[model samples]
Target chain A: MKDRITGLFYILAVILLTTIHSIELYIGFFVLLSVLSGKDFIPVMKKTFVAVALFNGVITLAYILIKGFDYGYIALINLRVIDMTFMTFLFVRRVNLFRLFEFSSILTYLLVISYSQILLFKRYYTEFILALKSRSIKTPGLAERYGFLRSATGFFIEKSVKNSSEISLAMKSRGFFMD
Target chain B: MIELKDVSFSYQGRKAVENITFSVQKGEKVVILGINGSGKSTILKIINALLFPQEGTYRYRGEIITPKKMKDREFVRKFRKEVVLLFQNPDTMIFNPTVFDEIAFGLRQLGEKDIKEKVHYWADKLGIFHLLDRSPFELSGGEKQKVCLAALLSLEPEVLLLDEPTANLDPRSTGWLIDFLYQLDITVVTTTHNLGIALELGERGLVLSENHRLIYDGNLSEFLKDREKLLEANLIHIHRHRHDDMEHRHYHIHDDFS
Candidate 1:
C-alpha cells in the first residue's frame, strides 16, 4: 500500500476516534503506535508527549477556573490533540523530501516574472570575470588554462554532487520518505 | 584480532579491492594511506560492515563475518557496539541540533539510559562542555571534529575507523586530532591522504597503490625517514622534506598545550 494512503487512513481514523471517544483513548492510541513501530521517531514522540500534556493541563486549569471543574473543555482539547498529532506524524513520516521540487514545474512562469532579475545576476558576474581576466592579459597559455579548467570543473562537480546527496539523505532520515 | 583474508570486492564490472590480507591485534593504531582513487574509503566501508566482501573471509576474533551472520539484528547490534566508523564528513554523520544532542545520538541509538550524564561526561572530557548547547553548524571545523569524536567515544567502541579525517582541516586542528587519537586506548584504523597526519597518529602505516593493492606496511618513523621510498609511493612533497631538517624535526606548534 502507498504510505500516503496509509497515512490518510491514520489521520481519518484518529479524528473519528477522538470525535467519538474521550482524550484518554487518544493518548492510548499514541502509546500503542510508539510501542509497535521502530523507535526512529523519538524526536517527534518527545515533542508530542510534552505538547499533549501541556495542552491538557492548560485546558483543565481554565475549565476549573471558568466552568467550575466541568469536563466540557476536555472533549474539545482531546479532539485537537488527536487531529494535530496524527497529521504531524503522518506528514513527517510519509511525505517525500523531493516533493519540495514540485515547485520546479512552475519554472516557466517564474522565468517570465523574474526575467530581469536573472539577467542582472548573470550579466554582473560575467562582466566582473571578464574585467578580471582582461587585467591579467596573458595570450596563449594552454597548459595553465587547461589546469585551471580541470580544477574548476572538478571542484564544482564535487560540491554539487555532495550537496545534493547530503540534502536527500537528511530529508529521508528526518521522516520525509514516500510510501 | 581482526583479519581480512583473501577478501575481494567488485562493483558492476570493475574491482574496487582484491585479494587483500591484513590483521590488527587489540590496541593497534593502523593507518591506510592512498591517493584519490585508491579504494581506501572502500576498505574502511568493508571493515564497517556497510559493504560485504564478494569472496574470502572477514574474521573478527574467530568466527567468519558474512551477510547471514550480520543479518541477525542481535549480532549486528552487538557488532556495532564493538566497532564504529567515523565518516569523512561531519555534516553527514551529525544531524542533531546542538553539540550535546549530536554526542548523545549514538548512545540513544544504543538505548542507553542516563543519557544526560553520559553526554555531559564526554562533553567535559572532550573540552566541548561550553559548546553543548550551541548548534553544530555554527561551530568551526576543528570543533565539529572534536564533537564528533566525543560522540563516537561515548559509545566506547573497541575499534574506531576514520576516513580521511584531516583532509580539509587546518594544521592546528589536524595536530590536535593526532594528539587526541594518540591518547585513546582503542584499536584505530584510519585512512589518510595527508602524510603528515598519518605519521603523527599511527605507529604502523599501510600504503595503498592506485590499483587498490597494499604496497607497504611497516613502522611510521622509519617510513618517514625513507625519502626515496616516500617519493616512490607518491607521498613525498617539498614541504615535508624541508621540515625534516634537524632543528625542526619534531612537530610541536604549541608550547602551552592550550
Candidate 2:
C-alpha cells in the first residue's frame, strides 16, 4: 500500500477514465465507485461535485457560448470530471502519500517546504484578520478595506520572496543544487 | 475584569488548553508564563475574543461573552473600545499607509472626531512622532511595535492584552516598554516565556504546563521559588557547568531573555 503500486494503480485508473468515451461506461464506473466508497460514498461524492462545479460550470458555459448546447456531451464530461476527482480524494484519504513519494528525495523536500510554507501563510492570514477585527469598533469603510487588502497583499508577497531565498540558501547549504 | 470558568479549547482534535480556569481583576497586572507551545498565546487569544472556548464559559465584566452576544452592535462597540490585543508580530497589525494613519486607524473606524488629537497624543507617548509621515512597513521591528501599541492605545482601552510584548524588543526598548507599562493604570495581561523578565511585567503569574493546563496560579515570585512547579512546566532544566575547575550538573533556568 505504501509503494509505487498504489500510485500506479491510481494513474492507470485516471488514464482509463480520461480515454473512455462511452457515457454508459462512465455511468457504470461511477456506480462501481460509489459501491467501493462504502460509508464515504455521500461525503466523497459531495466533495467531488463541489470541487469540479466551478471549473465544469465555466467550461460548460464557454462550450455553449462557442457553439451550442449538447446535453449528452455535457452529462458525459461532468460525470468524468466528478469521478476523477472523487477517486483522487479517496486516494489521498486512504493512502500515506508521503510513503508513496519516499523514492524521490527531491519530491519529499519540495513537499516538506510547501507544507511548511502553507501552514506559515495560513497563520499569518489569520493573524492579519484577527488584528483587524480586534481594532475595529465598526465595519471598515471601502477605502480602509482597500488599504487593508493592499497591505495584506504586500505582506504576503514580501513573505513569499523572503521565504524562497531562505529556503534556497538552506538547500544550497545541503548541496541540493549540485549538478 | 475577566473570568474563565473551566474553559477548554482544541484546534480540530488536538487540544490547545484543557479546562483552564483563571480570573483577572480590574487594574491588575498579570503575566502568563510557559515554554513555547504550552498554550500561553492561546489563553491570550481567548481573552482577546479571537478564539472561544469549546467547553466552558468566558465572562467579561459579568456579561457572558459569546459570539452571539458579541454580534450585538452596542456590545461590540463597547467591547472593541474596552479590550485591545497587541499581537506577537507587529507586522500583522501594520497595514496602514503611514505611521499616523496606523495609529489613527481604530479611532477613525469608530468615527471619533478627535482622531488627530488622539493619534498625535499616542504617537508622542510611544516616541514614534518623527515617523508619523513614514509608512509603517518601513519601520524597524521595535518601531513597528510602538506604532501598533499606539494604535491600540489610541482607543483608550481599559484592558490591554499583550502577547509577548517584548519578544522582538532590544534591551533598551524592552526597558522602556516595561517602565511605560508600569505607569499605565489599565489592567494588563501579558504572555511570555521569558522567566527572567516575567515578574517585571506583572505581580500575579499564571503558569501553563506542557500539557496545556494551568499548573500554578498565585503570586509571581512564589511560583518562581517553587522548583517542582518550574520543573514540571519545563521552564528550568539540568545544566552542566564548571565549578572551581570541576564540572558538575545543576538545575538552571536559561537566562536568554536578557
Candidate 3:
C-alpha cells in the first residue's frame, strides 16, 4: 500500500512540476530535497548536474540567442528541469519501482528482465574501453579509433538482436504470450 | 619484473582489492585464484596499468608506474609493449576490421615494420592463419580468443596478464590453450575461479578470500593440499548425496572430482 501510494505521489509531483510554473515553489522544493538528501546531498546533486548540465546549457544558450537576454525565463526553464530530475532521483532511491508497479504483472516482468540486461551490457561496454587501453602500445590513431567505434557498434547490434530473440523464445516457452 | 606494494583499490565505496602485495620475477607464472568479485580481475587490471592502485605503488622494471608516468609517450610505448592484458571477453580486445589487421594493430602502432610478416607468424603459430581475411566479429568464441592472443603475442610482450581466459572456452579449446600457454616463455599471470585448472595454469597461486583480502600466496600444489585454505577461499564446497539409499556428506573442490 505504501509503495503504491509513494508511486502515485511521485507521478502527482511530476504533473505539478510540469503544469505549474511558480519559480518560488520550485526553489523551495529543491532546497527541501537537498536538505532531505542529507549525507547523499553531494553525490545526488552531482549525478543530477551531470545528467542535465549539457542539455540545460544548450537550451539556455539557444533561448538567449533567439530571444535576447531574459533571466527570469531562463531561471524558470532550468529550475523546472532540475527540480523534476532531483525529485525523480530521490523517488527512485527511496521507492521500489517493482513493488510500486506490482499492479501490472507484465510490466513487472519486463522490468526484471530488461534491468538485468542493462546491467550486463553496461559492464560489457566498460570492458571494451579497458581492453583497448590495455592493448594499445601507443596512443590510438584516428583509424584505430574509428575501428573501435565500428566494432563496438556492430557488437552491440548483433548482441541486441540475438538476445531479444533468445528472450522472446524463453518468454514463449514459459507461456508468456499464449493466446 | 613487476611489483606491487600494499596495493588496494575500490569501486565507488566498496573495496575490490585490499592491501595486496606481490611481485612477479621475470618469466614467473602466477595464477590468481578467487571466486567472482573476489578481486582477481581487479588485481590483473592494476598489474596491466588499466586501473591504478588507489592506496599503493606499482613498479615495473624498477620504475614506479603511475598515471603521471604513463603520460610520458616513451614510457607508455615501452610499458604497453612490455605488458599486455587479455580481457575475460575476447570481443572486447578485438575491434579491427579483419583478423590480419587486428593481429597487426599493436606492431603498426609502435611504428614497427614488417607488420605482415609478424601478423602471419603469430597467426600461423596460434592456428588462425585460415581466418586472416575474415572479420574477427564473425568468428567463433574460441577463434576470436585465438585472434586476440595472436594480436597480443605479435607485440612480443614480456608480461601477459590473462583475466579468466578460459571462461568462455569449450573443453577442447581450454585443453589446447593450456598446452599452448605451457610453451610460452613470457611471464604469465592468469586469473580463474576454477580450482581444478589452477594447478595446470601455474605452479604458484595467489588466493583472495571473499572479503577481498589476500588469504594465501604460495605454491599452488601446496595450497590445494591444504583443505582449510581452500574452504577459506570458498574454492571447495560441502555436498551431500545418497549411495544405495545411504545418505552421506563430503567436501568437494570446484571442477575437481578428486
Q: Score the docking of each candidate (DockQ).
A: 0.02, 0.71, 0.75
Which ranges in model 2 have alpha carbons more than 4 Å from their true place? A13-87
Name the weakest run of 10 consecutive residues (lDDT summed) in model 3 chain B. B249-258
Candidate 3 residue runs with Cα over 4 Å from true position:
A1-6, A13-94, A102-105, A171-179, B241-248, B256-258
lDDT for A61 (candidate 2) = 95
lDDT of 1 at B134: 97
Q: For candidate 3, what is the DockQ-based docking class?
A: medium
Q: Worst lDDT window (10 residues) for model 2 chain A?
A: A1-10
Q: List chain B TM-scores, each candidate.
A: 0.86, 0.97, 0.97
- Which digits, one per residue and each the tens of the lDDT, describe model 2 over residues B44-160? 888878898899999999998888887898888889999999999999888789999998888877889989988889999989999999999988999999999999999889999
The pairs that clash in candidate 1 are: none
Ranking by TM-score: 2, 3, 1
Model 1 per-residue lDDT tens digits across residues A38-156: 55467666666676787777877888788785564566576567456745664556554234323464543334434544464454444333322211112214643453344334434
Q: Chain A structural similarity (TM-score) per candidate?
A: 0.41, 0.76, 0.84
> Estimated TM-score per prediction?
0.55, 0.88, 0.84
Clashing pairs in 2: none
Give the TM-score comparing model 3 with the true structure, all chains together. Answer: 0.84
